[model samples]
Target: MSFEQFLFYFFSVVLVGAAVAMITVRNPVHAALFLVLAFFTSAAHWIMLEAEFLGILLVLVYVGAVMVLFLFVVMMLDINVARVREGFVRLLPVGLVVAVGMMVVMAMVVGARVFQVESPGRADGDYSNTKAIGELLYTEYVYPFEIAAVILLVAIIAAITLTLRRRPDSLYMDPAEQIKVQRKDRVRLIKMEAEKK
Candidate 1:
């Protein structure tokens, strides 16, 4: 087999293994780490397909930023593992069915060559996929792109709104309350008679 084919199979195996590990691992942090490995291998696959920009973006955006944020949140949050896994057995069959359906669809798409290219020739030396993508995005797909951005913004706002809660038991200092305080409010001078010690 060619070196390129060997590399493809090698990375594919790694990617699949990482993905499996990501889902099966009990520790969320370890799962996130496995996801990072999966992302790296996927990026390699993208680069092999001559989509260098997407490969780099997958690494930088997902692995570098998103995964790091995920890791931090996972580490910081007081997650109840037992509570989280309580529904796992109930959901297992549904999850497996969905997973199998997705695999079948993917296999069908690959076998049918649904995404076959019209021209398989290598791009010119001066050609830039980044520029082409930018032009297409800004020109033809701008509306959809803007809509996606707005949806993401709304999602972020919704997530923050959902997770934000005022805890009655937690103590918090209000800046306005702090600023309004006078010396008398904080301190009281006590007059006392001197006593012989």
Candidate 2:
């Protein structure tokens, strides 16, 4: 086997293992870490396929940014693992069925070569995947790209709206109240009567 094939097999094994561990691990933090490993291996696969831009993006966006945020949220939150696991056994069969169905569909898609395209000539040093993707995104797929951006924006807003809560016990300062404050209101001079020592 060629070195490239060996690297592909090694990464593929690691990717699958990481994905399984991500799902099966009891600790949410460990799961997130496993997901990071999975993302890294997937990026390696992309790089092997000569899609360097996508591989770098996958690492920077998912592993560096999203996974770090996920880890922080998981670590900071008070989660009851027992309560979360309570329904796992009950849902195992359903999950397995869905997983199997997905695998079958993926296998069929691969076997059929539904998306097979004519292999282009090997890339020259001047070829750039990022530029090509950017041109397509801004030109042919502009509308769809804009729509996806809007959808992501809405989702972010919705998440913030859902998680935001105000507690009466917590201290809060209203911007309007602060703006309305005057020097006289903030300071009051008190006159004291003289006392004998």
Candidate 3:
């Protein structure tokens, strides 16, 4: 077979394997690492398809930032996987129904030939995908984009706040509590009598 076909099959196999391993792995960290491998393979496939910008963005954004963030959160949270899995069997039917429904919907949309398999849009001379995306984002989708950014900002702040819930004995200062501090009460001098040696 051709090099392109070989590469495609190789990446596709790795991607599928990583994805399956990601879901099936008992260790959360290992699952997350598997997910990263899946993401890398997906980016490779995108690059193979000549969508250079998307491939690079997928690597930079999802692999570099999001997946790392996910892994850190998974590791840091100390989630009890066994406890979490306790209800999986009970929820199996619901999960299966949702999965099947989604597959059906996807099949309908894809099988109906809605997404025409045309030559990649940038097949011609020097068609700038980044420029086109920038123009679209700035001109047509600017408001929605800004709103989404604000929503994501709020989500990040909320995640930080939730994870930072501290005991009264904890040292981390909350700005809201700090604002109530009084200058007169700030520091008290403790008098220590001199001990005769």
Candidate 4:
């Protein structure tokens, strides 16, 4: 077998193992780490497929940023691993069925490709994937893309609104009020007689 084939199989195995570990690991932090490993393996697979831009993006965005945030959040959370695991025994049969169903579906889809006509030629590399994606987003999919962005923006605003509170006892400053304040509002001058020693 070629080196590429070997690398592909190696990455695929690692990716699947990591994905399974991410779900089964008792420790939340360990689960997050496994998820990161899965992401990295998937990125490596993308690289093997000649999708260099997507591979780098997956590593940078998911592994570097998202997984780091996930690790921190999972570490900070007061999760009860035992309690979470309690349902696993009951859920295992259903989970296994779902997993097997997915595997079967994937196998069918992949296996059917042998009978389909293959498209010729590779996509031009002159334009980066990011540029092509952006072009497509802004041109063909602009409305849907903008709608999704608006939905995400609304969700962010909702989260902030839900979490934000006005605490009467807490000292806080308003930037707008600070910016509008005159020197007199913040400063005071006093005259006092000197104390005799």
Between prediction 3 and prediction 4, the one with superior TM-score is 4
Q: Which digits, one per residue and each the tens of the lDDT, describe model 4 over residues 1-197?
A: 99999999999999989999989888888888899889989999888866788999999999889888888888888898889989988999999999999999988987896657563346665756567668878999999999999999999999999989988998998999889999898899999999999
Model 2 accuracy (lDDT, Cα): 0.93
Residue 151 miss distance in model 1 (angstroms): 0.8
lDDT of 3 by residue, 85-161 (tens): 78768887997899789889988998876587676576678887677678879999999999999999999999999
- lDDT against the true structure, per candidate, is 0.92, 0.93, 0.87, 0.87
- Across 1-197, the per-residue lDDT of candidate 1 in tens digits comes to 99999999999999999999988787888999999999999999999988899999999999999999999999999999988688778888998999999999998998786577575445568877788789989999999999999999999999999989899998999999999999999999999999999
Q: Report how far off residue 42 is in candidate 2 (Å).
A: 0.5
Q: In model 4, which residue pairs have backbone atoms overlapping below 3 Å?
A: none
Q: Model 4 compared with the native: what TM-score?
A: 0.75
Q: Estimate each model's TM-score.
A: 0.78, 0.88, 0.71, 0.75
In model 3, what lDDT does residue 150 have? 100
Better of 2 and 4 by lDDT: 2
Q: After superposition, how far is residue 67 of candidate 2 from its true place, in Å?
A: 0.7
| The best candidate in terms of lDDT | 2
Off by over 4 Å in 1: 83-89, 108-114, 119-123, 167-197
Better of 1 and 2 by lDDT: 2
Please state the error at residue 123 of candidate 1 in Å. Answer: 4.9
Model 2, span 1-197: residue lDDT tens: 99999999999999999999998898899999999999999999999988899999999999899999999999999999999889889999999999999999998998886468665456678877788789979999999999999999999999999988998798988999999999999999999999999
Clashing pairs in 2: none
Candidate No. with top TM-score:
2
